[model samples]
Target: MMIQKQYKFYAAHRNEELNDKCSNLHGHRYGVTCFFEVERTGSLTTLFADFDDSIEPHLKREYDHAMMIHVKDPLYQTLLRHMKETGETLRLKCFSCPTTVENLAHQLFTEITEMGFRLNRLEIRETDTSVVSYTREDWVNDNRYFASYQIPPSESVS
Candidate 1:
């Protein structure tokens, strides 16, 4: 059997590698839907994963109203400068990885796997019309051999 859940989060980010206006900061009401593969448990309940227990809380914490800033982004330092100059509280949650939709999919995949849910597919939608999907099989076939999210030793924070 297969069970699915859809989750949402509001976040802001920018992509510096791009040549267009995306170089400016922007926000999105991102949507993520995960498909889970499951088997009947024990005496025979069809339920495999609970949305509230397995997913929602984590999404709410990691992304809701958060800022996704790549570590190499200069804005990262700019934000720090502003904080130091103004003594203001910067409540934004900074992500260690780039904030593109593809990276978001990878981030969510890592989280879902760590939570022990058996996932079949993950769909990350940047907008109502723009979306990207990744299957578990795709991750297995990736050249990085599923270690795509690892921080290289030279880049690791001290």
Candidate 2:
């Protein structure tokens, strides 16, 4: 037995490795579809609310309206310096790797699984026409190379 859910988030990112327009900072209305495997024995294998409880808050805090950037991105340091100097806040979700749809899928998959959900697969819709999918098997194969996402510490007032 299995269940599926769809979620949406708006975020900004750039692909530094790309030479095209994608290398420029841009935002997207991302769509995520998650599939979970459940046991067939129960009257309700899982409640839909359980999914929302686990994922919605994470999406809101980390990805929604946030700038998803790699720590090595030039803009990252500039933004951090500006935030410290001017005492402004920027919602930055830093990643050890590029903020690509594939990586996003892996990150979310790992998170959901770690939260004790039997996640079977995850799909990220980067754009209207571009989508990336990851399965449990894929995650197992690539888990060794996955780098966890990072959140920069707040600057101390001096």
Candidate 3:
């Protein structure tokens, strides 16, 4: 019932609210796993959404080589000034709150959901090994108990 696609992008960001070392402007190669539920009768066409044609252009254009900045952050001005002085148009995405991994995941999840995709989950990784996963079940309003399955146990787990 669930399907996923992984994507890669590079970005610069600093988390002002947390005041952690991430408070410093830096870049990272990010990995994101987008999850969707199969629609036997999909809304778009044959499938839920096209990665290359649909999601790619929208997400890649905003995130690839982009800088994430909160408007309240002092570094926001610095980055703007630098861009103005250098005459280099850097891809920048501004957030109202701190740019944390969790926040970014939620942001993407919201956008994808608005696009009419039944987003099941989202996994964000700053590195290949470091990952954070999110789902509607992760938040309070969407929480519910899953019906216990009586299927046989998997050999892999045993």
lDDT of 3 by residue, 1-158 (tens): 67778778888888876656877789889888888886556654345346546677766777888887766688877777887899877677876556778767767776677677778888999876789889877632322211133222111000
The C-alpha stretches of model 3 lying farther than 4 A from their native spots are: 18-20, 42-49, 84-86, 139-158
Residue-wise C-alpha lDDT for candidate 2, range 61-158, written one tens digit per residue: 77899888888779888988999999999888887678888877877887788889899989999889998889999898667554232333222111
Candidate 3 local lDDT, residue 9 = 87
What global local distance difference test value does model 1 have? Answer: 0.74
Q: Top model by lDDT, which number?
A: 2
- Model 1 poorest 10 in a row by lDDT: 149-158
Give the Cα-based TM-score of candidate 1 against the true structure. Answer: 0.82
Q: How many clashing pairs per prediction, in order?
A: 0, 0, 0
lDDT of 3: 0.70
Count clashing pairs, candidate 2.
Answer: 0
The TM-score values for the models, in the order shown, are 0.82, 0.89, 0.76
Model 1 stretches astray by more than 4 angstroms:
42-49, 141-158
